[model samples]
Target: MRLEGVFARYGRRDAWVLQNVDGEVRQGDTIVITGRNGAGKSTLLRVLAGLLPVGRGKVRDRPDIVGWVPERFPTAQPFAVLAYLQGIARVQGLSQSLAQKTIDAWGERFFLTPFFATPLEELSKGTARKVGLIQALLNPPQLLVMDEPWEGLDAQSQAELPAVVEELTKNGGSCVLTDHRGRAADLGDVRHWQVHQGVLKEEDAPAPQEDAEHHVIEIVVRTDEVGTTVEWLREAGYDVHGTRERR
Candidate 1:
């Protein structure tokens, strides 16, 4: 997908938030958008996600499935959390049993199962953002767009996001996201863009150190410790996987 000379604003009377922007998000691509507050980064993300129509030019070759997560999850809806997620799953083409099962698994992964049945309006900001994230992740999206996705997440949830995006890109999917907290610095080999003064600029990636060497070591811990063992690994941006040991 590509943005071609796009110009956009919130309303007819509002000043243009993005002007003559051009970019490409190709298969296996992870593009990170960054800028100071109110610098039109969010607007550019919306345009990429096809949520906001551009005032001029166009986004070409959009994917069929797009997962869009806003900066703030809206909590004014009238549905319970689980029910809302179920609806999204159905829309995303999951069967009832699959939806429930998937939701259950992700709920546990994000530590959100306790609030599964809670009303949306009653949940905290962080929890509400989890709802938005889980819905987008209910199914793999050809294009994933998240605006400030790490803003209100817990440490564990925040750690889980990069893995999700990496998996998608690994599968020839495309992702565009915003990171305001500088937490995405370790996301690994991603295209970085700055949206400033209604224009977009691509930043050059740092050159890799020729002498850098990384080693992987696996250790088995006590069963009880397994529950929390991956935290540090995830924080340090190491890939974590579970496997069965042969007898």
Candidate 2:
């Protein structure tokens, strides 16, 4: 997706929250938006999710299948966990059987299966966030937008969330997310963007090493594929040694 001179604000009378923001989001890109509180980070995410309209300029090539996990998961909703996720699946164009299967799979993956029958209002904050995250992935989206998705999640869930995002990008999708606590340490390869005074700029990636050095790396494989694995490794510029059988 590409943003060209994009400008946005809450209302016509309100001051602009984003002004002349320009950037491009490519496939497999993990973009992180960082800024102080009330600096329009959420608004920028809303725009990218196609929830907020641009006041001027253009945001083109946005994916139609956009999945967004808001910072605040609405707990006042009346639907139960499974029902709500099934509804989201239907909205994402899944059939009834497929929707149920997806709900079951994601519910188990996120540890929300036990609470499948519980109403959204009855769940704890962490559980509610899990439901929120699950809804976003009922159908793998082409663009996944998350605002503080790591908040309120347990240690295990927090660790798993980055892996989920990596899977999306690996499948040729993209992600845009914001977090304040620096909890997303696993997303080290992300493009860091800081929004300030309604302007956006790409932070430079770390420089590469100037010196070349060789380091020892150990390889282990099954006996059957040892020859092929060793040959491939050596072709890729690795120093290969004879394989030793382990007792």
Candidate 3:
């Protein structure tokens, strides 16, 4: 999808949230939107998700299968967690049986199984956010837009999200996410966009120093999941050398 000369605002009385914003969302791209508070990062995501209409210019070729996880899930509704997600699946064109199956799988994966029967209003903020995240993945979408998706998630859920997003991009899906906490771990080849004064521009991240002096410190882990530890190190940009043995 491409946005050209786009402009947006919440209301007529409000100032423009995005001004002449021109950008592109390509397959296999993970775009991270960043800015200060009230900098219109969420507004940009909504515009990309097609929830907000452009006041000027145009957005072209937005994916038909779009999944959006909002910053806030409306937990004031009266419905069970599973029911809400199944309803979302149905809206996404899944059959009842398939919706149930998908919901069950994501519920287990996201640790939401224990709250399947819990009412929306009764669930905590973090748990409700899990449901929101699961709903977005009920069916793999061509364009996945997320606004502060990791805000209320637990540590395990936060760690799992990067892998899930990596899988999506591997399958040629595109993502646009807004993160205030800067906690988003290594999503490969990510393009960072920053919003300031209603203008968006790509942030130039500093390249890693290749010739910097380094020291090696071996960590002797007792568990059998050494590969997992090594993978984490590599993702954190370490030059790992040991691959002949697993312990």
* lDDT (Cα, tens digit) per residue for candidate 1, span 101-210: 99998899888999978999998777898999999889888999998887767677888988888889999999898885566776787999988899998998634447
| Ranking of all predicted structures according to lDDT, beginning with the best and ending with the worst | 1, 2, 3
Question: What does candidate 3's lDDT look like per residue over 1-247, in tens digits?
Answer: 9999999998988899999999999999999998888888999999999999999989999998888998778899979998888788888899999888888888888889999999999876678888888988998989999998877676567778888898999999998998765655466678889999789998775345466587987777646777566655643445556754445
**Model 2, residue 170: what's the lDDT?**
95
* Clash totals in order: 0, 0, 0
On the 0 to 100 scale, the lDDT of residue 29 in model 1 is 90
Residue 56, candidate 1: how far off, in angstroms?
A: 0.6
Provide the overall lDDT of each model, using Cα atoms, as 2-decimal numbers.
0.85, 0.85, 0.84
Residue-level lDDT tens digits of model 2 in 1-247: 9999999999999999999999999999999888888888999999999999999999999997899999778989889888888888887899999889888888777878999999999876678888989888988899999998877665567778888999999999999999776655678688988899899998864344475776776767898988567645633435454678877
- How far is each candidate from the true structure, as Cα RMSD in Å? 7.8, 12.2, 7.9
TM-score of each candidate?
0.81, 0.81, 0.82
Range of the 10 consecutive residues with the lowest summed lDDT in candidate 2: 232-241
Segments of candidate 1 deviating more than 4 angstroms: 206-247
